[model samples]
Target chain A: MLKNVFVLALIVVLTLPGCTMEKKEKEQGYTARDELLGTEIIINIKNSKEAPGACDDIFERIKQIQGKMTVHNIESEIAILNANAGVKKVSLSQDTYNVLQEALTLSSLTGGAFDPTVGPLVKLWGFDSKNFGVPTDKEIQDKLNLVDYRQLQIEKSRDTFMAMLPRDGQAVDLGGIAKGYAGDEAKRILLSHGIKQGIINLGGNIVAVGTKEGGSAWRVGIQNPLAPRGTFLGILQLKDKAVVTSGGYERYFYENGNRYHHIIDPQTGFPSESDLLSVTIIANQSLMSDALSTGVFVMGLYKGLELMEELEGVEAIFVTRDKKVFITSGIRDIFQLIDGDFSYEQYK
Target chain B: MTVILVMNNINKWITGGLIVLAGLSFIVLYIYQGSQDHGQPVLVIYKNGALYQKLNLTKDLHKEFNVTSGGHFNTIEIKGKAVRIKEADCPRKICVHTGWLHKPGQIAVCMPNRLKISIEGRSDNVDDISF
Candidate 1:
């Protein structure tokens, strides 16, 4: 105890003058904020606490951003965009315009597999209202008729966007890709605030910014399909990478021992019957991960694996119905299968 | 006499318990490492209309032959260490990447020829694959 006290006093005495001498040590270079996207949003930012106003400033900025993008925000630009689907030529904020552009681009890239106009299909399935129940065949078919993304056109030159139905009257749904697009924009807003080292988990799509300190990689745990919560297969170490997981388990309804999920195949207008239960995609761009997660899930295993292999920077982990595990070559090393009596196999 | 006797009894009991615990720990560790050794493979041969056979690659590895009996041509290639696939013949080229089934979960699917080769591992026992 005497030796420890002597060392402590010596350290304090030695540091006291240095602390007073260094006058400009309080300025930090990190800030963060969170904005509610629709009804749910999870935002985390890590920065130096020396800057007192950075946190509050970031938080307020996020709220302001959400006010423009969230569809649930009644006066939000997105809500206005959705409300005036076919009528007046409404001008849009630059942020909203940029997000819509990305949404349209991703929808085209997936060949309509990841359509943002899935709002009608989602609502028909009762998933949009936070209700995880199935609708009838007629309802699905009717909604399917309203779910063509090609009809959702954006005339940016006129600052006008329209969701034109193929027939006389059909509504457009931008639910599938809006949250992800919003999350990406929110990250941009935070970055513009000079905030780095943060994660934006809107619904299930996640966008991480910058890299963590100490050169340590961020280990994101993938949710197990069979496990209720908190249980994970293994950790994937990421550095400025976004990981998005789509699974039947995330949202499903059990009726008469048959389970129906939120992910519907556009070709069938019903839940995908693919053997895969869940798929998680890791990409540098959060939007790609978001769009690819849904596209790959609907494509099933064969085409999904091929697409993953064809892409340069994308890696995926697929869980099949029989609990079989398949991982892309990019992430085979980092994934560790835990707590399961299953076999760890790689598709060459 | 009583004090000496109590101390002696306590020492013996503690020593015996430690020895038992150490032995049990070793036994458990050995079983755990040994239990992960299950290999099962499914090799599916695609033909005209029916799937020919689902062979277990874990049980057999060096089995090979040709896929030509008539003028119908199907290109076969080995892509990886233990995966082989048939490139073309008809509809789906899924078997093109299957290579030869050497690793677990490695599959060869012939889309046009309707052949599928899959190597399955010990996954049935796992109730869930968590994130």
Candidate 2:
């Protein structure tokens, strides 16, 4: 009987750690995925009990945002605004106003390198329709005339906000910034539910709230542009931050052995021929990070690096065409280059 | 004196039993750990946010199948320990262009068709990936 007790006690002791580990994993949270804003979004919440309710609210909020901002939706505020271009000031929803405000700010900051008015160019290149082709110079030039962010006008009258496009053909496409806005909204929804630890991945725009379980920072990988989608060149350890990357590899088509990517340079009215293949922005807010990633990609390497350095609380990683990775000083330590093929250096 | 001798015999048997049991436990643990090291990767496919299929990469070597939904289809091929969308009816073909995904946390998504494929493993190196 005594030996039996001893054996049972030994078994309990041996399995105790495993049992507890399994319990901890179960408590780690809930993960759900859905298609939104023309991309896949995955939301992971650390609190299992609150995940279902919070995710429902988050997805609902995103759908509303998508409805208002999407140019494809004819009833969307953006499409209505486009229809009224050079005609009248259109009333805007608060969310639409806020996103447009941030987008315009980024436009001025990047000196139109990332124009919200690039909608005409986006359509001309068939990016919006996915009928990819290279447009003629005259066609591109005509679209370029209407692709000026300055023509986008926004005004406020007491509680109501309005926006207008001064030119008849000008239009606003929040494609560059909408997902980030959605991520921010999702983060807000999660936090409002008293859930502090979560990861919101809106397509590729990542917003990490708090840290992983055990107070460890969330590890986010940066895609290696030259390799397949899942391949990562480096990882960023982040907490309460947003990471956004814009690359030619994301959306492009081949024509005459040359690639025509989706990210068009407002200046050239063609796919950006920037020396860098991708630009990743790490910032406090996803909206800023998303817009800046596109803006910096258009700005090229030297100018992009300068802009990132000048901005407070903003850091960037530029993967150049030569397979060299350049990171801002702030992210130098946290960004780990795991891939050996690419060499990294801190932008002095 | 007789009781003392019996007590000694009982102690010897108990100790011997414990040693054997401990040895057996250790051997069992070793095998469990070894099996874990050889844990097979799984290809988890989701269509319209619902689990469509789960394929064992090792066992499904060179298996080719088609996943169709809403008149859209993607041809999935499992080669060795990797899986990829060999062909997709989606216009952009981004899912096909994503190439093969073998490691945990690697995912290929066809947004137009609402189809997603990922290799599921025990643990992933990163919480998420930004592209």
Candidate 3:
């Protein structure tokens, strides 16, 4: 103890004069903030000469995506398709076709766990409106008939693109995958601006561009579902990847002590009833990880694990309701537990 | 001789018991530290999933405002550190039911109106942001 105290005192004495020495860092990259898609979007760059101009361009790109994809916007491509649902085939814009096509591919991969056609069910449950109420079994079943990706017909060519939903009651909402596309597009803009390293946080969809300044891997926190927001269960060390999580705590309603969230299961017309509380997906593209997070969440532990195994370039961390965390092989080495109570277990 | 053996056994049990107590206290301390909110609370309001405004909850007294978007209207009232949606034209009074927002990171969203309000702690110096 005496030797330790002596060393501590010596360190303090040696550092005392340096306390007044302040050095300001130049080339501190810009972080432009704006409200997009009903969430705060922050774009941070490591080093930049034209901070304002680059940030303006990044925000502009996000705005364009939001305008084209937002379902509520009457002039948006999605709105046009939704307006013509079950009526006629409507030609889609280039961006809409790509996002829709990606959603379709993801839907097929997850077996409809993450569907774009659940709009009708989302509306019936009043998740789309302020008239939120519980829906009857008959009501859910009726809407479920319209909520099939198979019924969402797609026709495309080099110059023109069109899509049609089978029935009039059916609708399409791309809330799940659009943000991922936004993150990916923003990354493109940042790279074009000569941003070698940066962080794009579009709400919870975090996309790390390259590595951090000085060549350190980005450390991302995973939300603790059972606790308040911003409280994390652990950290994920990643480089040039997007980390997205899907959980009930972000957006949900509690009625009679039962929690109902926006992620409706395509099989059932209600909030998914699964043993899992949250699922975090990491991948090269934010769109893939964002959509897969929800897809895996609805698929639950076993089937979700199967989905992760089949897909390449994808890693997942599944947190169950009982506070157990299961990690995919890719994340095993990089996953660091912040909360001691939660154990990271591997399952075959 | 038997008494001496019993005393020695009791001494061994005490040492083990002290180690166990230390372990339990360490766990409790860790939990207590994790539960603390490190920074000052700020109110952040979102519309259509984008941040519309951010206000310091501890300053400037009361601030009342109306958010109008796409023909939908919701009136927000902030008194001191608590905030709530006073009135909304949406069908269900879910936002109102959300009550007050006092704790940092607690969120109240009126999805129908495309309005969301959340309290942010000023001192949450996290290197990574979670979705």
Best by DockQ: 2
> What DockQ, on C-alphas, does every prediction get?
0.03, 0.49, 0.16
What candidate 2 gets wrong by more than 4 Å, as runs, is: A1-19, B1-37, B122-124
lDDT (tens digit, per residue) of candidate 2 on B51-95: 989888784478889999999899999889988999988877878
Models ranked on TM-score: 2, 3, 1
lDDT (tens digit, per residue) of candidate 3 on B43-75: 888887677998877755697889999998988
Error of 2 at A173 (Å): 0.4
Docking class of 1: incorrect
lDDT of 1 by residue, B1-131 (tens): 99988876876676556556555655665565456554344444545424555555442355445564244445544333344654455322324422344544333434334344454554333212222
TM-score of each: 0.60, 0.89, 0.75
The residue-by-residue lDDT of candidate 3 on A23-49, one tens digit each, is 223445667788787667888775557
After superposition, candidate 3 runs with Cα above 4 Å error: A1-29, B1-125
Best candidate according to TM-score? 2
Q: Per-residue alpha-carbon lDDT of model 1 for A124-239, expressed as tens digits?
A: 66665545566788887887876777876666556554333343234444455555565566676667667666666665566667765555566676766664333456567767
Between candidates 2 and 3, the TM-score winner = 2
